[model samples]
Target: MTARHRFDPTILREYDIRGVVGITLCEADAHAIGRSFATVVLREGGRRIVVGCDGRLSSPMLEKALVAGLTASGADVVRIGLGPTPMLYYAEASATDIDAGIQITGSHNPRDHNGFKFVLHGHPFFGAAIQNLGVMAAAGDWEEGAGTCEDRPVLAAYVNRLLEGLAGVDPARLAALRIGWDAGNGAAGPALERLTARLPGEHHLLFTDVDGHFPNHHPDPTIEANLADLKALVAREKLDFGVAFDGDADRIGAVDAGGRVIWGDQLIAIFAEDILRRQPGATIVADVKASRTLFDAIARQGGHPVMGSSGHSLVKAKMKEIDAGLGGEMSGHVFFADDYYGFDDGLYAAVRLMAATVRLDRTLAQLRDAMPETFSTPELRFPVDRARKFAAVGEVHARLAKAGAQVVDIDGVRVTTPDGWWLLRASNTQDMLTARAESDTREGLERLIGEIDAQLALSGLSRA
Candidate 1:
């Protein structure tokens, strides 16, 4: 008889399957996810599912086990091998035979962490769907069938698609621009090495090997500390710009020639204007935390600007609902629907950034300089018990409203004041409370920060 493995309930999440290395998850659990997910896919009449993984050491092992489970469920699996989360999404959207896709990635989480990003029938398979999958697995309801796995290298094809759009972009001046890249030794390195060969620019690289350890810096570029090496590279080489990627390369960050970090909203503004000029009156979406400047700019360019919740799956769902041309978050996830599938792709975003810079005949900093300035806080994270985080946000929201503050509660409570706006929300992926404040000036920004501090103090949380 086959051995029966106990299912750990926590590995199944609202958005995708995720957990630690051994305690909460393992190869057996991954096998269960694969099999169970495959059964779910097949039951939905899915014929093909695309699978891929990030550079986490456990990913390949888990992926192999997952494919086994899928095959056992009598489904055909197309392994996209190693690539970014977007590439997996791209394959699913582009392939007529594919009905679903699963990315075995931990995203920008710590080194030992891993997870899955699932798509079902061209829509995000998340929330209650993910939770229900867990119950089915524990019940051992996964179907048994003659499932087989086929290796499909979609990276080359994916790159070709991105390059075709950027093919006409000339690099005569970019050849003089020095560039620096930090893959964080994540999955994007191998692909980026090839992309750089096509560009005419002086380049420097760090952590190009796909090491799951992530020794030099964390793969998350949203955090300021992670960009230290990239900043140093820019200053040392006097490079025009420096770019960094998350573990899966679906998100990105950049430093200007002056070594200043450019937030996601600013990047979106740069891209939104360019996209609108080509396809006027297109719609752009951004998370609530993005600056008001971005929303205003999109409108100025004859585009509609919409704000929504802050999760990868949530944003993508909103993108399709509104048929948006572009969408992004402060955390660096950017989705494009103008020329490609409505999935976030950091590599693709970079290509467009390069083309925009080239086509406008403006340097990275020069284009950035043309945008209006506003004061904003970097995202601030404070530890809160998982159970209490949401409640705290609720309490804070209620109090802010009773106090007669102008409040918006899409993701959390974002209070709009005469001076500026402040946002307080519970992080979807971690046991933390996230906050950001922005205004027209330094004093206004500080007032917004102080408001957040007062609310946290009341909740028995601290900035420290």
Candidate 2:
């Protein structure tokens, strides 16, 4: 008889199963996830699964335990050992017979934390599917049989595929451009080093060694402070632009020749311009936190602009539903359903960015300068009790509705004004409320901020 298992309920999240290792998550939880997930796959008539792990210290142990449960549950496992989360997504997307994929990754979290991201039949496995896995684990209802496991190293193939994004890019122009890349010693390091080696350009790389400790810096690039090293490198080398990736290489960050950080919305704007040029009137999606300038820019470029909910899974679903050519978020997850798979891959985004620059006949700095000026607050995250975050958004939404304010409540409450817009939403991944405001002028921006503060006060909270 097989042993029964129960996972810590808190480890199951909106988009993935995550927790601090040894505290809320362990090898046992990993095994339970594999068994339960395999059972679910089998119920759906799926028989093969792909498993991948990051370079974290805890990943190997988790992967071992997970494979045991998966094989025991009668699912053939293709173990793509030691790669980024996107690599797992690629493996599943590219496989002819694979039914599911799971990646053991800590993402951009601190060293002590880890988690799993999943894809089922080429779609994100999240929300209710995550909760169902917990229920199945608790019931000890899993398939049992002897299943096979195979080892496959796919880094070189993945890197080669990324280069395909540069098909129409001018090679002479690519060679003329100097670029810098920083992987922050995360799982994306080795892949980045391999990618740049074959690309056309004067290339320089930083911290290409896989170090889960992240001794150089935290792997998250969205936070401006974490990008200090990359910015310094770009400046020192006078590169045309610099690119960086989050821990698992799913999120991207960039800086131009002047070492100015390019926000995610701005990156999408660049991508939209290039993509819309070829596929006119294509639907392009950006999350609510994206700058209004991005939406306006997409429209000006003859593309349909869509404001999507603020989560990668939600955005991906929306993209498929609308057959969107491109979709992205302010947090740096760019998805391309145009010429590539509709999954968020930072390395792929970087490749497309290079192609965009070369094809447009403009350097990154020139592209940045071409955008209209807008004053926007950096994403503000304030602590709120987990239980009250959603309720608070609901409360704010009611008041806005009552006042007949011009608002968009797709994800949260985004009030639009003659000056600009302000948004308040509960973060899906953390116990916090996120807010942002943007305007054409400083005074208008202040008004938008004040509106956000006023809305928060109504919920008996203060921005921190």
**Which ranges in model 1 have alpha carbons more than 4 Å from their true place?**
1-9, 171-177
Q: Pick the candidate with the highest TM-score.
A: 2
Model 2: which residue pairs collide? none
* Cα TM-score of candidate 1: 0.94
Query: What CA RMSD would you report for each candidate?
Result: 2.1, 1.1
Residue-level lDDT for 336 in candidate 1? 85
| 289-389 per-residue lDDT for model 2 (tens digits) | 99988998899888999999988899999999999999999999999999888999999999999999988889999999999899999999999998999
User: How far off is model 2, as Cα RMSD?
Assistant: 1.1
Q: Give the TM-score of candidate 2.
A: 0.98
Residue 367 of model 1: what lDDT? 76
